[model samples]
Target: MILHTFTLTLGSTRPIYGSAHELRGFFATKFTEYTELHQHNADKFIYRYPVVQYKMIENVPTVIGINEGAEVLKQIFNDYQEIRLGENTYQIVERGISLKDEEFGISDKIHSYVFMTPWLALNQENYRKFYTLKGKPERDEFMRKILTGNILSMAKSLNYDVPGQIKCDTNVRFQKDRLKDVSVMVFSGKFHTNFLIPDLLGIGKSVSRGFGAVQQLKANNEGGSTCSSSSTQGAPT
Candidate 1:
């Protein structure tokens, strides 16, 4: 999996919410061509994988660009400096870029995994219906099925073909603060993990704006069999 993360450290400290929207707006101003591609894809109702995704981490607007997007971002932002977010203008004080692959401790084999971001698994119709329906138990069960299916669909779209029935367990919590009800899910089970490709690739709806971004929280150890993951106790980002 070839993935590159570009962390644009900002000079401002003011609280900036709805960063995904701001990031998209910035791309529209500077990278109009790519921005148009994003809009076009969204309108087409296609599964065309988004190469670039943006999120705010530690007051820094980080762009996790994969494959072609990585090259584009490096070319544009490498020489260009500074980007604005919302009402507050931020100076690009520092820029950090790094790549992650097999050497980065990501296992090729399948194993239990957790999400670094919430996993959104519904479309426009299903999403609205899900919220309108009553009963937490039924909602939770439906969420698990949809999420697992979405993962499989994502893998297929990425050319990671897995045969037969794939089993997975999901533990998720609904985050109401987002644009809608997004589920923060931890997925565990056995399957090929190599096809997941890009680190922090968004899975479901609004992926271009960073809705379903995920990171592997576990990796197979040197033993090639045992998986290792640290216990992170904190609120979901």
Candidate 2:
């Protein structure tokens, strides 16, 4: 899953609404919002660069990605485990970075926001189309620059170095590719023993499923999940 953290700048106490699908819908909505404000100029460069936007005019006072999910993810901080990526150690929480909950960081002028997720279905479809096309050397180069640049920029902006890059699958591949995905218990509450995920053996789904699902599950039982794979307890060699 993508690991990201956001501060509740709008207020000290915030609550999250909707599902992963709804959250994705909201991100998609940001695209439209950007367009309506005549901010689509940024999109032209966004998909091809390390920057979030080319035009600074539209950088409104809102958040994107994981920031929207800030309400439902408080206990998220306790889920972290250490991982070896390239040469550095990263705190991996919720299958990604182990950032402090609701903590905000700076990025020059704008407040840098962080968030993460498994590959959404749409993102995967687009990637397959772009990355799998053979003999298109130029397109591949562009993809590498944009995707890698974004990740690198993100790390550098946080004053951290880029470790080995992480690319999560569309929940499906995470399950089928259990040998690659790390296994961690998703503890349900403040208590370490209660887990949202049932078994330690988990795998991301390897198929495409429409929409996404997060939970309203209580500490006693976890709601239905989207899916991932189980792996040995440590970093991959």
Candidate 3:
């Protein structure tokens, strides 16, 4: 399947300091007509894969649009000249936009990826189950399943039918994090999977707020496996 992706990066005169959630709020409020920007319909949350994701890469405000979201991004690429975040308004000095068609599906080779941001892999229920596991082996296996499910969810959202089962292995460490003032557990690590995912795409929960952004590292030879390295802690941008 060909996944259509659009990325927009904004540069300001000075450093921009804000969370992806704040950045999203700026756009969702400005483009209230575009429900995809915020994934909301009349105060009710739309529970599906988010086509549009907000992020802060290297302290720069970035927005990613997938498939239908890509078209919406194109229509509003030039609609704004400035952005406001928490009482600070920054003038947009540079705008970078990219549109590409990327291959998306199961591959024969195992591809490695690192989480550029924290992966919100567990919810309250899953957190209890995860802790109940006996040892590292059990926990690792559990996380692998979660990772595979994340990939399948993304494929389903894109309407792509997977012909084969996805295989995933993860090397992650748990960390304490907070989401929306609630304490939560997050992971920072790398995983190897047969599924091919676009760079900067997110997985797991609260992805619209920039959690779980992944960057591809390398792809091993077909039918070969690559081990994942220990991941360091990373805070959300």
Candidate 4:
């Protein structure tokens, strides 16, 4: 699994946790719903996305590729330094372990995990090629197919297992201006969730990515939201 950390602004007092599948599903749904609700087709809103990060704890294996991907991650973390992990957030210099062992005076073997640098992809074919995925009433059934296939393909290319587990923070507010389908899909969940989009206006870089200090939550759960609570649709932002 591509084990990485994500930085976000905390929207609720509740802690957030989920499997990789759940997290991806959470975002994919958010994006799709928002766009559809605004009556925009998925193709129109869909674009090749960045590697959304998730800050990992010490001892978690990190494989940095020796390529463009590595360079991007390096640049990404340059200005960004903190991440919101569930309720607790931290700075990279304080929270981060060495991306490479030598910098930390540790042997490579002791680290075990390879520093997956960016340029390793030979043909440079791998990042992601997310096409405009049209959403329908039966979109849930297609989630596993599109989300699983695409993510797994990237992990396989990077030589990591499918990140079965994923963690994320919640988006404070829902973007109001979008597609009609997006709104329908967004509210069509078991319960309401905090994760939404950056804003009604899609400006700036991906809001999903960042590194900074954050407030922590005391609550925790397996996936989605409350076990028995209905999850509000989390359309991609």
Can you give the lDDT of residue 110 in candidate 3?
A: 82
Writing each residue's lDDT as its tens digit, candidate 2 over 175-222 gives 111212544211111111111211111112211011111221233322
Q: Residues 1-237, candidate 1, lDDT per residue (tens digit)?
A: 333444333343444444775876687567666643244443463345566677665445667665566666766765455567776666555666766542222344554444545555565656676778689766655654565555555544445445434333445566543553544333222222332334556666566666666655466322121111221111121
Q: Residue 98 lDDT in model 3?
A: 92
lDDT of 2: 0.24
Q: What is the lDDT ranking, best to worst?
A: 3, 1, 4, 2
TM-score for candidate 3, residues paired by index: 0.91
Local accuracy of candidate 3 as per-residue lDDT tens digits, 14-44: 9998889999999999999998999999999
CA-lDDT, candidates in order: 0.52, 0.24, 0.83, 0.25
List candidate 3 stretches off by more than 4 Å: 219-237
Q: Estimated TM-score per prediction?
A: 0.67, 0.22, 0.91, 0.23
Which residue pairs collide in model 1, if any? none
lDDT of 1: 0.52
Give the worst 10-residue stretch by lDDT in candidate 2: 48-57
Model 4 alpha-carbon drift over 4 Å, by segment: 1-46, 52-67, 75-93, 98-142, 152-237
lDDT string, candidate 4, 1-237, tens digits: 123322322222333342222332333344344331122355664333233432211322121212233344444334444334334444444323234211111111111111111111111121121113344423332232222232233334335432233222122211122221232111111111222111111111221221111222224222232111122222122
Top lDDT hit: 3
Q: Lowest summed lDDT over 10 consecutive residues: which window, candidate 3? A: 228-237
TM-score of predicted structure 1? 0.67
